[model samples]
Target: MSLLDSWTRDLHEAEDGTIRPTYRKGTGPGVIVIHELPGLTPAVIDFADEVVEAGFTVVLPHFFGHPEARSNPGTLTGALVQVCTSSEFTKLATGVTAPLADWLRSLARTLHAELGGPGVGALGMCFTGGFALATMVDESVAAAVVAQPSVPFAIGKKRAADLNLSPADTDAVVARAAAGCQVLGLRYRKDRATGTRFDTLRELLGDNFVGVEFEGKGHATLTEHRQQEAVDRVLEFFEEKLKG
Candidate 1:
């Protein structure tokens, strides 16, 4: 519930005029933190701070374009009601993650060259969970940790990230797993929105997947009541897998 005093935070703009706010702290390895559907909120910021405390450089790249949004009923109604009602919303949702995937890949390389390398690790949740994995394809990512990845459950809103990845793409990630790179993910036992996405990932990863199924826990509660536990486990996982 507290922001790490030592962390450095700023908003960076891409060449495309997209503004991305990122928070970073600590030294040694790097870990990119991607948020849920709600975008950059206090909760996601908390997650970033905790990752810094865990002893890695935590970069939370704000890709939502809409700054610091919350998904409370009223706020979501105001922002999304118009878009959702529009003809483009459905199609937009399906392919929204593609540009983001590209952004992360580019950022990963930038983090390596500009911030210095050994590459980086990742942590993504809800809508953006699979993004870490997508970034790994760029070779600048050494590890990934995803939780409750949603959009790709049936069909990724973005055409490129479509839930239906081709065999070649799937093989590349599988090879990454085999190559000593590590990827982990989590889910609640009761999250209906995520549906069976976690299940599919589990089967795909087999022994390589660091799967943690919360007991009696739903999606929201996974990061809510057990924030410290989640942070600790994820940090340890990154340190072990990525640092190794």
Candidate 2:
């Protein structure tokens, strides 16, 4: 059976006319769960299921790759190629928001308008991690979680520290943070894939940035390299920010 059989699948269209498949389930406040490098693997679905059980509506948008495919080197490579070649993504540029973020922000606004809450929660992992932070620039996203945000490819010092946000978008995120919207970040201290962006987040968001760094080496905190403690912190953050 397909892992997403239980999810209500629909194609969501952004204001810019960008349409993508989205799978939604559960109830209560809404949360947008953007997949990682490969796609919506079973592990990613499992995490979303836990969020559903925790009493909140969750939406998984199919940005790229085959849904429910297991994460493997081949899958990762294929997705990377697709993302890199696509204009929607900013693979190696610094201080620029991926064009994909506009669609994501539109999705957040739609979900928030439908749910009728103060805002919606957004969790982006790995390749899409910083997307949650970008989406938070809008008032619709109240709780933003970025787990191992590896964007701009982390190829060099500049890209490593890049937040993958344009100057205007960065200012908007900073303003939102100052308005009391807290962003949660998770990653391993030694995970070079994430680069030094966490430090940049600290400098930019100040006290509004709540960082959860695990010791040792690992990546994909909420999916591939799942950590119970980190998962718990994410749930608690969602509860406090989205449901409180």
Q: Tens digits of per-residue lDDT for model 1 on 50-97?
A: 667777777877654244555576654554454345442232344233
Candidate 1 regions exceeding 4 Å error are: 1-19, 65-71, 77-97, 115-117, 153-168, 225-227
Q: Residues 53-160, candidate 2, lDDT per residue (tens digit)?
A: 999999999978898889999998899888988999888889899988989999999999999788999999899998998899889999999999999889989999
Report every candidate's CA lDDT.
Answer: 0.64, 0.92
Candidate 2, poorest ten consecutive residues by summed lDDT: 216-225
Candidate 1's TM-score reads 0.77
In model 1, the Cα lDDT at residue 199 comes to 60
| RMSD, one per candidate, in order | 4.5, 0.8
